[model samples]
Target: MPQLQEPKLIAGNANMPLANAIARRMSMHRGKQVGLVDARVERFNDGEIFVEVFENVRGEDMFILQSTSNPANDNLMELLIMADALRRSSAARVTAVLPYFGYARQDRRTKARTPITAKLVANMLVGTGIERVLTMDLHAAQIQGFFDIPVDNLYASPIFALDIQTTFKKRMDELAIVSPDVGGVARARELAKRINSPLAIVDKRREKPGEIAEMTVIGNVKDKTCLIVDDICDTAGTLCKAAEVLIENGAKEVHSYITHGVLSGPAVERVTNSVMKSLVVTDSIAPTDAVKKAKNIRIVPTAPVFAQAILNIWSGTSVSSLFEADTLSPIYDGTYAAE
Candidate 1:
């Protein structure tokens, strides 16, 4: 790998903690001091977004870290404006690093007059002059195709598998990984295979956004510890209902592992009162104060993965190597045993 100019990291108001953690990992990996580029992202009294890049970015590889979470529209606008500002400032390349891509659930339309907002968001980013995109665990993998530019969609399965092994240890064989809906069966099945656990699916139908009809457990879960896996946990309606039904069907205990925790509305309340034993989520989107205060919630840092990916992209190396669920190498100090 050849050395290009040092890449510049810029974070939006979306997830500063994850961005800072990523920067720390990058500095450690490079064996050199690395820090975020100075930038200001703010809003006016009328709630208009503003973005300003303090340092010169001319010919520098710029990575803008932003997750369109709670205030999806606001954070999204911030990212777009930042990318536009970077291009106008003469950046060599602008990579939008979206750990949790919002509007992804609406990748397609089921009705005649619905909008494909995910594609719209992609078009907006590309039109704003973003050269590339780096996101993780999109609600739909096909969303990557929506962008004309190169898109890297990272996975959180390896991270969850490592933590599951560490947490359950000898009890993994007594576990069953479940998908809350048929759509997530592939993700759950992959994790189940990694841990050698039985796979189950919660057959569910969505009545409307943020709501689910009665769900049925597809596989045997009687007396087995159940682990429901999915990409996003928003509103908690589906997860809470799935956990309740899984327990009603005789599961010993219900645990959840998800990539993005967009715990909106009464999500925390629902999880706290639900039958789920615990909910583990990655720090793709920053956790709210309520999420941190919840007793049944755990957070796993995802910085090492993103940091390594960014480094690989900057060095023109193979990013696919990071996807393997083997022992994480020198990059992560073998801290993450992917299996």
Candidate 2:
């Protein structure tokens, strides 16, 4: 077992709900072991971030929890500065545990003179002296290659599967799993295989960046309940459009399962007007005002899953087993496996 004995967990201002949830799963409160001095993140006269970890972290295995979500640049700087602070404090190893790796979708260029922001983010983390990256459900698997150090890309599909199995147990016979677009076909296929249900795909044609035309459904969905699965839902364009198509194709009911709910700019309104029965999202990105007020939106916590992975990693066990969707009864059942 790796036994990161005396491992230290620190958190920043971003996504405190998720940080506290993970800490609870670890059976500890935040800042119980060491001095978590007041973090004063304020801008200077010219607008530059300043941070200092008031506690000693010398020779400790430190994990800093911060999500680069809304206010992406500020949160990102906080993570970078936290890592730098730990490194300067002589920590043995510093790991940036980002539940949501922002800008991950910009892994490649769609046009000339474009920047791969994902790689740039990785370079920034490397420059901050971070030794490892622990994140969940990246937009692209190859983003792991963007980092020079060990990057553990975790999946939330298994956790979601448990939820769906219980929620729709009675309707399993008439259920259908759907991918919002061609890019998410693999992810949707994996989830479908786990639930032992049929898979479907929506092929969308984009006349431009903002305008998406949902072309057709590649699988049978008539008289069946549809579950559209995707890694993230940013503008809610693809998800909403696909659900509309499914309903138009005689789908009895439509539901969505998206990992990261980066619901920005009128997303809640779009979902409210869409045909989806409900939108299930994780705590990857903190919910906004509209998302919280939206009647059809539901939140599924990923704390237990991330905590278990951390425990497994600390105990020197294989996290690969977490990928299989069959053993995920705890998520929807409201009970968890501690073994």
- The prediction achieving the highest TM-score against the true structure is 1
What TM-score fits each model? Answer: 0.96, 0.92
Error of 1 at 217 (Å): 0.9
lDDT of 1 at 226: 96
lDDT on C-alpha atoms for all candidate structures: 0.91, 0.83
Top lDDT model = 1
lDDT of 2 by residue, 278-318 (tens): 99999988888789889999988887667666655556576
TM-score of predicted model 2? 0.92
Off by over 4 Å in 1: 327-339
Q: Could you tell me how far off, in angstroms, the CA of residue 32 lies in candidate 2 after the best superposition? A: 9.3
